[model samples]
Target: MKTFTSGWAFQKPDQNYFKKFIRLNNIAIDGIVYPKKILADIEGIPVLGFDDAHDIIQPDDLVLDVSTNPDLRKELEPFFAAKDIDCVSVPDYLDRLLSADQHDALLLPVAGIKASDIRKLKSAPIPDRFDAHFLDAESYEVASKLDGIFRHSQWQRLVEFDRDDPTGNVLFNVLLDLHARGLLKHLSA
Candidate 1:
């Protein structure tokens, strides 16, 4: 069996219906594990810092950090669907599955969001549509900072990993898993 894991520090806890879907499909999950210092409580869901999640991922589990680019989550939707992968949000618990050594998985970083078009938006006019979008100021700040780092350091890391292991499709696999579970709403055209 193959499984993929992903989590977004910004993803609302109430929006975790995807968890039930993955369980119904019997997919393995790897939730993002973070150090205590970076942890924050968001409506009761434990959110981790992007750097912390990246630093602690296990090699054997397919890990995903969605803090970098929310759109990347959309990009990955179809791929996870075709592959029939399972998704998980936590990483430490995922280590338990690694002990079996019977499954294949991918580890994805939330770093890819750096490559997204958010930079373009800085100069672009704010969409009239967002007037009613209710974005909190703090969320905006965190996302802006994360995007900057992802474009620089995180993007470099992902490129290096891909260059070293071209056969691995961590990003694609996670996208597919999200798609399969119908959790990939952002990607819908």
Candidate 2:
């Protein structure tokens, strides 16, 4: 499930667009309006209080930061980062989802998301290296070399022979796909 917290930063967000975005992605998100100012009457999502949000949000939950205020960013960024909560601007999220076509829902909106409340646009950051949290050193070596990304189906088709590799052939398929995309080089036999 996705989670969000709307802060004092929001001026006039497109509530209707937000609703359609959630529905199109079928994201089961719980949101809260802090300072009790944002009176967005989201139909399915419940408006939670600060205390409720603190208790409910865990690691991986995203905190929406629509503010361009440096002071607000300084104060909030560390707090959320310490708690392992991801903070993202709504615009960035929408762009990534749309561009990647990563929506999990069967039905999607034909139109694009409108960012009426956004002040300054935030650009997506390119990763310098892969985070080897769940991967071993050997796996990390290959993963770290992946300088680009492609659709899984495209990669899968490139390695079509492994579809029946009973063991799932996950790492091999991924490595092979990266190699095919020219994202991996100097691979040892």
- Report the number of the highest-lDDT candidate: 2
Worst 10 residues of 2 by lDDT: 147-156
lDDT of 1 at 52: 50
Please list the residue runs of candidate 1 whose C-alpha ends up more than 4 Å from where it truly belongs after superposition: 1-17, 23-30, 33-38, 41-46, 65-189
lDDT of 2 by residue, 12-107 (tens): 343334445567657765664453324554454566554566677777766666545576567556656656777776655655554555343333
For model 1, residues 56-117, the per-residue Cα lDDT tens digits are 44344454433345664654444434344333433322333333323323222342322123
Give the TM-score (vs. native) of candidate 1: 0.23
Query: Which whole-number lDDT from 0 to 100 does residue 97 have in model 2?
Result: 55
Q: Give the number of the best model, judged by TM-score.
A: 2
Q: After the best TM-score superposition of candidate 1, give how far the Cα of residue 138 lies from its true spot, in angstroms.
A: 42
